[model samples]
Target: MTGTPRLDDPHAFIRAHTALMAPPMVPEVELHLAVETVAIWEQTEEALGEMGLPPPFWAFAWAGGQALARYCLDNPAIVSGLRVLDFAAGGAVSGIAAMKAGAATVEACELDAFAIAAIETNAQANGVALTTRLGDLVGTDDGWDVVLAGDVFYEAEPARLIGGWLETLNARGATVLIGDPGRSFLPQDRLERLAEYTVPVTRDLEDREVRQAKVWKYR
Candidate 1:
């Protein structure tokens, strides 16, 4: 972690390693995205001399995020004038969308230092405002009127923790929305379908080039 390029200057690292690309489903927003998964992951791991780091999810516009961003853009009423939190906000996609849609406040929660930097960079690129907190925020509800998460159900442990938090928030009358694309851990039974979208994705990360993702309101 000492003097690692990603740690030393995340904004520069992102610019060097990735290109700015517009997600096909959410054309209005652009992000610094990885062109290929393996090469970028390998290079970063080799530079840091560590292998346990998770994939660079913050570099890509995931299917779930695309669906959520599109929904927020098309239906500004959901976030307009509301305090919104983009849970596990990778590159601040949905949060940026919420801000663009006239959200009163937008914040992102991410534990990874690299991801936190990426979100700020991406937010600036899109002329959106974003405040990032460094930690897991599943246990705290700060009266957010809208809580949106994208592609967070892929892993089991995180899925369990975040799912429970969302449920609690829903019970408290906060509008909770999840953007999921057939992830194995998504709690489908507990969600009410809101919208579905055909999101362009990389085959290296998913089974298909385009995934049909759904936005669900926690119920």
Candidate 2:
């Protein structure tokens, strides 16, 4: 299977914790991927263990992504029959959501091999077919009707880089939707609020903090 990556045990922590929802086993219209998350401003040394990375900690299923997932699941009208791209998609929740909502195709883009592997496993666990692409938004050109990003503006450098890429995409007339739960560097003025929601997490979830996340569009 050229597209199917190997699956592994990504739920050790979730299995230990009951609050977390197991990835649904049935193949259905909607799919959900268990993403990783770290608390806001936690030391990189402490946070990298879970994600297998260093400072500029890597977190997944952040509230912003959760909100977008919720919105996509609830609004099939928007995603149905469209080609969707989930940018820097750690868990691929938004991409899966779009697939569930009837998007013609869902692609998960991430630079980390581990994250890509995680998406591969979760997509199968949820019974939805997804495509994986190893891509970085900073200097990559991908054609997508809607470029979805979740909680990607937590740091200064990534924020600037992704922002610049988004600006270029916007200039070319692509719809860019960002989901951020008020992370320190979220560019608020540049987007229009689409929706908001509260997200839950496991005990190990660093931030362990649930916040209101919003979906904003720049089209």
Candidate 3:
């Protein structure tokens, strides 16, 4: 339990390291999430033997994602019959919510291999179908009708790149939605608020029990 986990079978690794549960804000759909944040981060770092690897963001249901998923569940009409892209989808929470809300199709895109496996597992657990895309999809347009991005504006550089790309997508008439808990780099001036939620979160991950999360549409 102290050493690196074998990642040859990412599915098995995810199943062994996480539990199936519902996020607090969106209980209608279940996800495979890590019970302990630090433990999973340490384990993944050890397994990869690299300190530069990103933290296990996919292992937890972030406040922003929870809020976004809740909005999708409450207002199904927004996504019904539209092709959606869950950009930088961590655990595919919003994507699963969209599918349950009657979306025509959902593609959950992530760069982490473990995230890809977790997305597939979470999709199946909720009995929702999601297409998993593994890579950096920035600066690319796939002609999706609706694009959902949750908790993606945490850092400066990535936020800059993704924000510009999202603006481009919005200009092209694709409905781009962003969910965020007021992260440091969120482009507030370029977004129009759609909805807000008081999302529950774990202190180990967010340093608080609740967060004021908002869903925004690019304007």
- Best-fitting candidate, measured by lDDT? 3
Which candidate, 1 or 2, would have the higher TM-score against the true structure? 1
- Of 2 and 3, the candidate ahead on TM-score is 3
TM-score for each predicted model, relative to the true structure: 0.93, 0.74, 0.95
In model 2, the clashing pairs are 29-100, 36-60, 39-207
Q: How many clashes (backbone atoms < 3 Å, residues ≥3 apart in a chain or on different chains) does model 3 have?
A: 0
lDDT tens readout by residue for model 3, 1-219: 544346677788788888899999888989888888888878876775563446678889988888888989899998999999999899999999999999999999998888898899999898889999999999999899999999999989999999999999999999889999989999999889999999889888789989999999977
Best by TM-score: 3
Rank order (by TM-score, best first): 3, 1, 2
After superposition on all C-alphas, the RMSD of every candidate to the true structure, in Å, is 2.4, 6.7, 1.7
Error of 1 at 72 (Å): 0.2
lDDT of 1 by residue, 100-158 (tens): 99999999988777788889989989988888998889899899999999998989998
Give the range where candidate 1 is weakest over 10 consecutive residues by summed lDDT: 46-55
lDDT of each: 0.87, 0.65, 0.89
